[model samples]
Target chain A: MNALWKVARFTATDIFRSKWLPVYTVFFFLIAEGLFRFSGDSGQALVSLTNITILLIPAASIIYGALYFYGAREFIELLLAQPVGRKPLFTGLFSGIAGALGGGFLIGTGLPCLLHGTADDRITILAILSIGVMLTLIFVALALLVAVRSDEKVRGVGICLGLWLAFAILYDGLIWLVLALFADYPLERAAIVMTTLNPIDLGRVGIMLRLDIAALMGYTGAVFEQFFGSRVGFTLTSGAMLAWIVAPFMLALRSFSRKDF
Target chain B: MPPHDMGRHCSSLEMMSAAAGQILRLLLLFSICFACMRTSAVHAAEVRVGNGVDFAAAVAKAAAGDRIIVPNGVHTAIDVKIDKPLEITGQAGATLDGKGKSQILIISAGNVVIRGLTFIRSGMSYVSDNAAIKATGISDLKIENCSFRDNFFGIYLAKSSNCIVRNCSFKASGRLESSSGNGIHQWYCRNSVIENNTIAGHRDGIYLEFSRNAIIRGNKSLNNIRYGLHFMFSDSCAYRDNLFQENGAGVAVMYSKFITMTGNIFRQNWGPAAYGLLLKEIADSHIERNRIEGNTTGLYADGCNRNTIHFNTFHRNGWGVKIYANSSQNNFKDNNFLSNTFAVSTNSSSLQTNVFDANYWSEYTGYDLNRDGFGDAAHHPVRLFTILIERQPTSLILLRSLFIDLLDAAERALPVLTPQTLADAHPRMKPKQ
Candidate 1:
């Protein structure tokens, strides 16, 4: 535990010294504050903030995770040469990245909402904050997994970009195509299960349900309420979200522990 | 009509000799007229009752046209019946508690007046509609300035005409739909005026079934379990300047004619089956100058015809207005549909019979090059996405997605799925209001 904290503390401070963390934090703060100031209603501002954060957090976290891991190849090799166990080193490094990104997100968006939001806006704000941090953790873990599996730098970046595009855009397009083709079938619960397969879609569904705008979806909204708004549905969604964070990080940890570097 | 008339109504006179009964009936009519004349000649008697006496005892002892004054205390009464024409007034802080077991007051005569009473806990039962006050088969009944708490029904009027229920507040906290009742429930009533009542947390705020010519004005119905106001099988009703907010299904008007709903505000009634106004099988109505905002669907028209919807503002609703194919010959003129998700969607309509002219849609992107108020290009309110969702309920998962917007744009350019003739011909460049 002591060695793990030492490695984690060292990695966090090293990243903190860079200017990109401050830039990302300031960007999030400015957007949240601007939305709060301009949107006449705070509830509306919270909704817009959730929409933007879900989109940006995954993309930014993926790119940053890939670039930082590839850029520190020599440092990782030097640390591995020391008297450190591979499991602690990998866990420590993963925690550092997850902690830095998630902490930055919560502080950036949470502070502004807590200051300007109304009493009823607290639960929604907290949910939005957690979703943002979860996306950051999930994407960073996926990027690290890609980085650990591949050796070529350019190919790793390409794979990360493709993963981001697939999850962020093409997945929804495929779902739409499936819906259009089978426009007559009863695929209600099937579509929701597909939504849980992708982390970005999970975040979008969570925020949309909170906004109470799912009713605008007509029949789909009712089905969503039935499946995702029940206690069992709530538990399943939270379990799926936790699985998204755990599965990718564990794979990346195992691969890093056994890698020849 | 007094104690004598009461005795006559309660008596079984079928065994009386025919000749003798004829002469007695003539004498009884003459005596009633003489008694009315004498009561008019003298001042109406006033009785101070119900401080320590029983409330039913007070009603039984009072004569017709007498004024009974109830003092400031709790009157625990069970099934008190008012059978004579009497004016009953309660002092400030006077209460009628039903003890969670029985109905409170039942008015059975004409020319009855009730005011300034607080009714509490008339109980809940499945067998009957337990109410704080119930008026049946009476003419010219008035209930004013009363407050009701936790009663199954606040004020129930059945087969009564020329009644006025004004300035009363009703509050019930029953959560389930079957467990609660309406605040003001009227059936088979005519020429009734219900004004300035505030109601909350009931099954429905006001329900008028088989009632006609009811003028409901300046009432606020908020946060009820079902509709704010629901009326069916009634005709010639006017609702003016009322505010309904956050009810389960907003308001429903079904199987009615000549409904003049004007200057009402409906906001934020959002649920799966909720709408700002649900109009079914209604015809020849004038709905004007209303503001509907933030509902799931602003107005839903099914089998509605010959209605004029003019000068209303529907702002930021799920669908501004949804019309079934059976709804025809309705005129939508000079209304502002602003920022709704789907402006107007139809099941499968050519819209050949209905008219959509001079309406401003916030999503309309056409320009007025001629400097006229109308746009040169026609604006079709039915988007292709609505049709897709209608075809497959699962496609609703793609709502608010970027690809759906692309699909809508592509379909707009080609005009494939959406009906071409369902459009606003003279789309206004700006809102009228």
Candidate 2:
């Protein structure tokens, strides 16, 4: 436990002192602030602003987490050479990164929402932070995995970018193609499966649904409406999203533990 | 022998009489056929009538199912009343000149088919719904391959069901606000299909009120005075594969239910009050597969519930999605948020009964080292910066300021005020693969 604390302390210290992390965090904050200000009285404007902020903050958090994880790995390796076990070292590194990310999130996004928010917006504000926290943990875990897997920085960044492209662009294009080619058959079933598989979309949809702009999210939620337009279907979709959150997390954790690195 | 021969002559006489009767019948048939041919030749629906008999008079003489073939030419006329089901076929280049006085055609009968006619310069009336073609109480009415220019409502469908308007173009006259007309207006109608039409320069490209079970597909609507497609009190309608661009308020889906909008493009719709698709008092609707780009607000949804938004791309919009208060029980999933100024914003955040899950946000900065492809933790999307921006519009000038950036970083470190409820329970490490 003491060794774990040391590892966590080391990670937190490194992240806290990093020059670039703050820059990125602040950059995200500014954009989020700008969007919130410009977002108007219309439901569309408000939803759009929230969506944009959600997208950007996670991206920023993930990127920073990746870099921080790798950067902190070298220090951990040195510590390992001294006498620390792999588990303690790894746990400490993750804890430290997670803490730093959590801190960055609170400072960059949480504070502003609190200071300027209405009594009614309290839940939305909490939702925003919750998303940020989840993303911070996710990135921390992912960064650790990447750091353990490869010594080369390029590969790690490449892998992350490739994943982003697939989730953001290729997946939807594929869904569209399938839908067009199989017009005779119902694609809603297939679409729901695909959506659950895409965690990014899951997160986005989950957050937007909470914000009550799911109606405007459009096609993303159509699959649920098709089978789940009924009460039973709605409950099923809700359950499916909940499963999406849990299943992937478990899988990621298992992979992290078993990875050779 | 003489008697028998006389009997044979009588029998032959009877046969001859029978042959005479058959010949008379044949002659009658031949005369009828000849008259039909002559009638067709005289009023050849394909014959150009620019200098010929009055087109209206020719139409009056047309038979119940004959073609009023207007050949490739121009004719100036007013008010061609169609009381019967007839094919009014115009040659490839034919034009009808309305002379800017009255409606070009008024169809009040069933199964009327109007095709391949270019109507120009119809009179505009503020008091009357003067249209190039006004179809009322008509069933199976088809208006195809036609053009209406400088008219009030190009084609009006009133209490008409199963009416099809396809491959048509409308350019409504730039009249004053009260005088401006809708491109295609349908009221109290059902089972109508408006497909593959281009409409511009009017209060609304397509307006449907109290209509139901309609399909608006494959249309291009642009530069309208109010909305590209405006609907009120409509239900069970589907809009797909359409483009709404550069319009005043884009498209307003208001006071409606059970609508499905898919595979449409909403772009360049700019104005203070502009939105790509607006939802008010909408329920049990499915809005999917739309490309909402470069609009003031990609989607503005309020007073809505039990709707699903999925698989959409919101790119480079001024504001991507807005949620007003009094909206609940909706779901947003599997969407792509790319390079928008504001992705999602909402008021009445306490009513946090909505769900947003499994969407790809370009701003997501997470990793999926495990190949299972999910972020290890939750992601809080609402930031203090966004909240500040929502509260203070003028504070946007400080967007790039170092102090604001520092403050944002501080907030991220320890979330204090941002909505605790605004988060993805599971944010994907990457987008969907």
Candidate 3:
């Protein structure tokens, strides 16, 4: 555990000094402030900021994770020559990347929402921010999994971008098609399960349920409310998010341990 | 139906018994006073009922145009059938208890007046629809300044014409929809006036069925189990300056023609199938100057035609207006749509039938270079995301997301996905004050 912390601290410092996280923070700050000024309502601003988070957070995390992993190849090789175990090195790298991204997102978007939003809106904003953080971690782990499997840098980046595209855009399209095709059947439970398969959808739905916009959703929104409105549903969704985070990281760790220096 | 008729018959019998008791008491009081007042100048025609008086017997013995005065006390439910023009007035604190078995007062004669009475505990049978005050086949009747509590129906006008019900309050705690009746129920009545009444906790606050030429104004109807004010097959009616709040679903105007609804307020009617006002199968109506706020849907119209909606404000609702495919010829002009999730949503892509012009939409962003108080470009109220979510409601999880916004913006720039003709040609530059 001590060695893991040491390696994590070292990698976090290296990533922090590169100044890429500042760029991410500034990007979010400008978007949030601009939305706040234009929309003229705190709730509307939160809604727009939530949209930005859902789209850009996953893409940014995946691309940044793959690039940072490839850029730190020499450092990783040097660490492999040390007395450090492979497991700790992989854990340190994953935590360092996820922490930096999550921290940047919080400071950038979350702070503005808290400052501008009313007291009643605090819980909803915090819930949305936490979902953003979870998406960051899940996508970073998936990116690492793609990085460890592929040998060439071009192949790794392609796979990372493809994964992001598939999860963020294509998955919803496929769900729409399936729902339309088999609309005769009772596919509510199946639809919910499909959403959990995509971490982005899970995060989106998790925050929407909190926003109380389910009344506009018609029937399916009612179904989701009945499922996710309860404590059991909340626990199940949170567990699914945790599984999404851990499963990819474990797979990436196994492959990294087996790879040749 | 036979069972319902039987229940009505039984309730009438109970009312007769109560009237008989009041009459017996009145006779005893008259006998005691007969010995003291032997002046022969006493007007024996005028029947006065004080404490422990037989009110039913007095009504039976009186002729037309006689006045019956009831002093302050508790009286039995008097179910006297009036065949003459009479006035029944109660003093302060006069109460009539129905004992939860029969109708409190039933008037079948014309030119009757009943005022200043508290009626309570009418029978609760769904078959009978027992009411505190039931007027049938009576013309030119006046019922005012009455309070009703825990009755199956508060004031019922059946097959009556030219009646006035004003300045009354009704309250009923109904646990189920099927078992409860409306506060002021009018069936087959014509030219009646219902105004300045407050009603709560009934199936419907004020219900009109097959009634025509009725005027409903300045009433507060709130927290009812169903609609605040519901109209069905009621034509040529006008309701103005009424307040409907927190009902199951706000006022529903259906199957009506030539109706005028103006200056009403609808608020806080939030539910899955709830709306501020529902206009179904209505035609040639005018809905103007209404305020609808904090509802699931501000106005939901289906199968409506040729209605004019003007100067209404829809604020902070889930959807400002959801018009189904069958509706047409509805003109929405000079209205304000503010802070709703979707300004207008329709099932079909055709916008040729309805007109949306000169309306102020908060989401409109076109320039007004001509300075005529109208935008230079047309404003499209329907979004592609709205159409998608209408098809698949679960897509609402992507509400306000960037991808949806991008798609909306792209669709706005190029009229490819959304309905091309569903644009307001004369969108107002500023909201109507």
Q: Per-residue CA lDDT of candidate 2, range A1-261, in tens?
A: 899898788677776676655865686567556555643222333344455544554455556656766666656556757876766666676777777767776777765565556675676666667656655565555555555565687788777666555654456556545655665575556666665565455444444444433232233233343443457754665566556445544554455456554
On DockQ, the leading prediction is 3
- Candidate 3 per-residue lDDT over residues B213-253, each given as its tens digit: 99999999999999999999999999999999989878898
Evaluated on CA atoms against the true complex, candidate 3 attains a DockQ of 0.20
Q: Give the best candidate by TM-score.
A: 3
Q: Estimate each model's TM-score.
A: 0.78, 0.57, 0.81
For model 2 chain B, give the 10-residue run with minimal summed lDDT: B393-402
lDDT per residue for candidate 1 within A171-195, as digits (tens), equals: 8899987776876687887799888
Q: What tier of docking accuracy does candidate 1 attain?
A: incorrect
Residue B78 displacement (Å), model 3: 6.3
Better of 1 and 2 by DockQ: 1
Q: TM-score winner between 2 and 3, please give it.
A: 3
Candidate 1 lDDT tens digits, B134-220: 899998999999889989888899999999999999999989889888999999999999999999999999999999999999999
Question: What docking grade applies to model 2?
Answer: incorrect
